[model samples]
Target chain A: MSAKEITVALVGNPNTGKSTLFNALTGLRQKVGNYPGVTVARKSGRCDCGDGLIVELVDLPGLYSLAAASPDEQVVTDVLLGSLEGSQQPDAIVVVLDATNLLRNLFLASQLAELNLPLALVLNQADVAHEHGLKIDTQLLSQRLGGVPVVLTSAWKGEGIASVRRAIAEVLNKKTKLARLTWPAQVESGLETIVRAVQADTGRAPSMADAQRILFSSDAHTSNRLGWKLSQRETVVRQARDQVRAAGFNPLAAEPLIHYAHLRKVLDGVTSGGAGKQGNAAALDRVLLHRVMGPILFTGIMLGLFASVFWLAKFPMQWIQSGVDFLKSVAAPALAGTPMLQSLVTDGIIAGVGAFLAFLPQILILFLFVGILEDSGYMARAAFIMDRLFSWCGLNGKSFVPLLSGFACAIPGLLSTRTIEDPKARLATAFAVPFMSCSARFPIYALMCAAFIGPLYGPGWESVVMVGMHCVGLIFAVPTAFVLTRFILKVKPQPFVLELPRYQMPKPRDVLWRMWQNAAEFISKAGTVIFAITIIIWALCYFPRDAQMAEKIRAAEPALSTHELQARTQAAMIEQSWMGRFGKAVQPVFDPCGFDWKITVGVLASFPAREVIVSTLGVTYSIGKGAEADSQHLRQAMQEAKWLSGPRTGAPIFSLAAVLALMVFFALCSQCGPTIATLAQETGGWKWAAASFFYMTILAWIMAVVVYQTVIRIL
Target chain B: MDWLIIGAIVGSAAGWLIARAIKGFQARRKGGCAGGCGCADKIQPPKK
Candidate 1:
């Protein structure tokens, strides 16, 4: 066992647990970035294969072929040929084939073998294969495919992984000769003629194998690399077409998808299952994809998911809040006499950290549901059901995955937009993704629900109201996308052609691992970014205190008891602080939205993020740092608060109409800082970020005004 | 108001410098972008 290393590229069809396998092998040695010249992320990691051999694994984006039609596919082709500038050629390629769909998986595998690269065939999900009563003769399959070693693996059960790893090491160490595809005679002759023509046109030399691939699958990058104009390509393609015809083959025929026919033959002979009838996957698909039942099932799934998020997050939210409060309480006694230290500890750090901590439950619950759906292979079914709806809204079906995931956070959702092949659809999905009513906006919805809607409506009705607010965000996104498509953006919609994979019970280990990873990421990210913003927000709301005004308010609070005294002191400080004055200055702007100066302060505070609205409201109503406290007392206080000037004068500033309007506005607005930052990174410019902000803010203002004006008139 | 304006100016300058430094680092890491290679050379066959 020498201490040696191998470079292996893991290739597979999308949703085949390629990532899960890569994560298992590489652990923490992963580095991710966009592939050169495209927005598709490239994930590479290194693993120490037992016996001191280091295996650097590159997990290429799952593509159906080496016949590169899209950027993701082109990436696979580029790395395999050692054409990508910053990347080295893989020493051996590990083709991960789904045991269930051996025919489809072998299409790309057979194509890769033709490139003369060392290859190992890994038939993954053997456990699933066995359960479904399928059998594979690995020896026969390997011998049929030029004697390449075939390893059967159940990535879930950790069965046969060591064999797969050993196969990869053997291929790399032995430099095993790859078995080339046996192309039909007619196709081979046509490819040869095109290769000769391409060679004669350019003086530089390329391998016959390389030239063949370039003719069929070369992309914009490849065309540029080969120094071939469209005219030249067209001439070559015409010659190839003529050759095919002269040999009595139809150029346009879909049958004999050339390499696929051979792969299918290999699959039919080697694998056995679902030969006579459809299996469990087909049975589940019957109802899940049924025209009428599909939508109903989707609706049920979505309701169940949202219900879980709402209920499951409550306990964690309370725990996080209590933890923050306890920390602040512990620090209070140490800094009693020091005013600046006291404010910095309790107001800046504690308040800011608490605001972020409260979102843990929402992030966890949302990812939990997403994990279950994705792992069970139901996400594709969901996309299939919603494709027509999304297409009608001028978005592609691929946009639905990211948008649904946006409920947890928009950053990853925006990243997931890479699945949308069409550039126009990708941008549109990114633009509209922020309107999916992310967890950051949950605090605003909760506050309005508790303050105005919850009591009058009851608990179940409040849940509906909360869900309705999310619906408002989603409802607004479609029309906005439609308008943007027609006027501002104007990218043609890409056709939706999503594949639904077979369903399996989500592996509990994978689900729990995902939850732990996401929760840790959420807490860590919140600690840094949100913590900094919270401190800035505290500073904005504190300081520049009117010395005389503070004294005047303190004198007025003397008659109050100890608890009341603390409450009054907190209020007086806020009223005399810089934030109060700023709120007063902007109060006129918020008047039409039916907000007074205090609510105006909350709105301003929420611009960095929407969830701060809850804490802002909590502080404004003197409900203490805790929102779980007496709701009635907070509501009464909010109801009794008066405005400096209004037509109705002294009327409750936040009537039902006003509260509803605020919720509607927050629902539609792109106020999350991370979303804006991601937009800048994804689009690679501030123009899109600024444009997104401008459009969302304007839309929010208009919608809020409309809701308030119409409702106030009715009342 | 004066201090607020000054703070805004400082923040803008700081953000710009950070952005510039990151760009410089990326440029160095990528080593001059995607296409500056000759992997796609075409071969000429011998005269028959």
Candidate 2:
């Protein structure tokens, strides 16, 4: 292969603007994917070297060391070591170092130099470094590090970025000499002995790169995978440690690790700055991450997100509604002669699918807020604040991000758990993720809220109740996690060590691309599972309808107008349908929870997914009109619906107690199929998925029953 | 007009099938020992 197509791996610590640099260089020329053999995703991009050369840049996940305690760090090991199949070892390694915190950032660079690869060090965030008045003699630093080239880069302002590209190009073009670590005499001897032992034992020479990979893979599984059989590996590491201690180089004990101490000493000698002070950014962090005010600020942020989803989306939703209405009108006269054909064409396909599609604006709005928080670097801070609360539930603060993301869709949220270093914590986060109120639950909540809460309180209360319902799910979910962790599954908790990335403006192209990707996934879902279910539901309520009985009903209700008689006939027809019978059969089970046969029917149909509950009510109340087809009018109709027989006390059947019980059930239930699939994938087995489903279903049923019985007794 | 439904479904299915097929080809092109040798590809690594 030509030198111009050389692969370059980018390695750095988190919050170092590594992603910013990637976007700057690639500029819409990137592909997002998972690394082979792991669920952790790999983002790669191609950038031109201002020559005929194309630099294929692979961005490795952030890590403090090669000690592969997390799935993410393991990826760093895999790529740098060239163990991953189908990927050639990177021809050059670019270590992105944060200039503001050069001491700590340089530790990884020092480690990378030991591998003796073609290396280029990019001093990222140079603008921040300069503002703090830090002056570094780059030539001296380079000479001390065996002449590795260094480029000062400010990724955000697009400053000195061209220098980084040129540095990588120079390294690939073989114009730059390779860099190697000038380890202390003792440490160097220890590594050389270990390398020889590995080669002798395995009957093959250990590549210097392979030696680095083994040292980083300290986790139990990775240690086994790398075939660490020499038993002498540990002895060699201890010997190296003894040498470092013997040097009388007692740096800060545990406060700064030994590698960091060495790095800090080297860095400070070559660089100088006045005591760094806050440059206005600290003021923002004070309010955003403050103990007393952070939660309140976060609440305001969430309120804005929810309000935008409901209010700002109104215009586009109406536009889509009118578009569907136009399709209906156009189809009506064209298929007049065949009533069955007309209903199937307009109602089954368009109306059923259209109702679900109308929620696209709402989903897009949700993504907009998510993108904003992510771009601002506030997401990491939010996760940090949540750590204290998570610790109480035997989970680390990192668990909060996955659960918060679950609100959008559980699949991607669950996929994100790879970032959590602890296996037990990752699994716990995955198990509790489905309990967070997802967008799928919005349809159910909107229907019930309109029917019960909206009219009972003001419109403002809709937002309040929506937020309150989410809070209820969140509050209950953690305790449930605590109980699960303590009694059902127990494991040691991992330490909370998170990197709060610096604040930078999110790239608009990335945000828009993410929004489009999410929208496409939602549309794909609507076409497959949602579309099939809608058709099945229409078939369920429509088949076995009687023309003879409809005529008889029309004759008997002669006083009623045509529209009224037609509506009554449809209701009569549905009451005699198979679905109505099935609802009645399951009525006894739900009687304790105060659900009538009609509500029971809705619940049964909602098994495929919870959002169908609204559409089910739409069809049941509309009689044979197939409630799943109408989205907007369904809520109003549900509010105006009455039980066949009035309450025993002559009150309306859908009492406040019944409404509360239903809400509790929805809050506790795991009713989404995609969530089940996601759980299965994350858990690596169906056992956890099945267990999650059964437990949540049983819990919801019990809570609903207790709520109804307690309320009935008090009344 | 109803054929639009047919067309859309066909188009989406074909697109999905093509995507899936491409993924399969890519996986095979790499040529691994087992089904899961592609695990590393699915992982999101840090961008350089």
Candidate 3:
């Protein structure tokens, strides 16, 4: 390939603005995907090198070092070591170092410099560095690295893109004059001996960087890339480690000391004036990380986030609800001639599906606040404050991110456990994640709360109840995690370590983009999973249509009051229907929990997903005597729902006690099919998923029974 | 006329839903997060 088409890889630590620099260099010119055979995101962009030249720039995942501990770090190692399939070794490397945190950023740079490849350095976030009173001497710093080209750029503000491009273009074809980082004399000699033998055995030249990676990594991919036998590699590495230790300095610990010592020399006097920013940061951290105030502030922020989901979304939610009602009204008139058809169209299609879609606004609003916290770097602080609470459960603070993500959707939340590092803690997080009240549960909570709580207690109390219902899962997470970690998994927990990023102003475009993406995903899932469930439920209730029941009601219409006749006829029609019979069969089991046969049927039908409960209820009531396709009508029917004939005859079924029981059931229920599938996939076996499903369902049932019996006795 | 419109609506909706389910199943089989999971393109294949 021509030098213009040479592939250059961009590497950096997390939050170093490497991605922002990549975007600045290759605006509107990137293709995003996963690396072959692994799930790590691979982002490649075509960058124009300012003259008839263009280079393909691939931005690899952020990392702290070359060590491959997690799958994400594995991809970075594969790419740098040329072990990844379907990808050529990068012809050039550009390391983006955060100028504000040069001391740490230089650690990765120093590691990469050992590789014999063409390389350039971009001191990104230079403006931020200047604002913090750190002035970098670029020429001196570059000269220290044997005259490698260095460019100062502020990628966030669109400054110095051209200079970075030029620097990369200059080194696109030339090989770096690679220097081996000096270790203790004995360890250095041992590395040389291993490198020579590896070259002699495979007849492939090996750099000291190659030897270091092979020794540190036990991943098969790394071994395969180095062309070393796994057993032989393991034995040789152990031997070398022992030899280096015997020579005086600790073997494994000596390399970092040597690299950092050299970096200290090179970076000397290259930057100055950090005391002001450090003092400012320390002052802020004192309050934000306060023992007394930190937890309270975290709780307040969480309360604000959840509150916005209900408050800011109210107008848009109402607009959506009105549209659903309109659809039902139009369809009702259009299908008036066919009662069965009319019921199915209005009740099944419109009301059932409409209720789920109406909550789309709240989902987007939830993600908006989340995106702000994440992008502004406050998310780490949230976890930091929650560490004390998590530690008691044998999990550390790192597990909190996954738990928080469960609010959006349990699938993604469960998937994010990869960052927890400790397998025991990660699995424990997965086990407890389902209790975190995912967005799917929000539809059930929202519809139920607004229909009952909003009217009786008003919106203020409605929001409080909504947020409280959401927290039910969070309230139980600690105990659930403790049980799984101590008794179930029987594993010890690892210490947690997290780096808090410097807080910065969040970019609006990024936040809006994230919101739009989340909305699209929610909308897409609604059309398939939610829509399919609505149709199935609508069909179930519409079937075994009893025309005779209607005729009997008409015959008694003159003798009986209209409301009584309508109620009796509707009750008779449902009793003979398939679902009503099924509900009756299941009713005895649910008696203690305050649910009658009809509610039991709704619960059973919603097994595929939790959000289906709203739609199922919509379908059920629409088929009953007081069938109304709108929200107000359904709420009215629920309020009037009564036992047909018993000691509790003529008593409303959905009483205050019953409603609370049902809320408790759903708050703790493992009802979503997607969560089951995801948990199974995440835990790598059906055992944990089955266990999670079992415990949550049993817990939900027991909680509902407790709530109902206690409330009944008090009343 | 009502039958024709109803038939068309049911047929098309079923077709669309089936097509989407098939597409989603295929995506899941390709070794990543399921489509309903927000992390479909981002998460690794099923872990051990």
User: What is the lDDT for A659 in model 3?
Assistant: 83
Taking all chains together, the TM-score of candidate 2 against the true structure is 0.83
Let me know the DockQ for model 3: 0.29
Interface RMSD of each: 16.3, 9.7, 5.7
DockQ scores of the candidates: 0.04, 0.13, 0.29
- What DockQ was computed for model 2? 0.13
Q: Which stretches of candidate 1 lie over 4 Å from their true place?
A: A1-5, A28-40, A207-210, A217-221, A252-256, A275-279, A319-329, A450-452, A486-494, A550-572, A608-654, A684-686, B1-48
lDDT of each: 0.67, 0.67, 0.74
For residues A617-696, what per-residue lDDT tens digits would candidate 2 score against the true structure?
A: 54465445442333335445555555666354444557767877887788778776556755776677789889989988
Query: Mind giving the per-residue lDDT tens digits that candidate 3 earns over A336-382?
Result: 89876787678777777776788899889987888888777677777
* Candidate 1 per-residue lDDT over residues A26-140, each given as its tens digit: 7732211111111235665676666667777777777776656555566677888777766677778888888867887887787777667788888887777787788898988
RMSD for each model, in Å, please? 7.2, 5.6, 4.2
**Winner on TM-score (1 vs 2):** 1
Return the lDDT, model 2, position A105. Answer: 80
Q: What TM-score against the true fold does each predicted structure earn?
A: 0.84, 0.83, 0.88
Residue pairs in clash, model 3? none
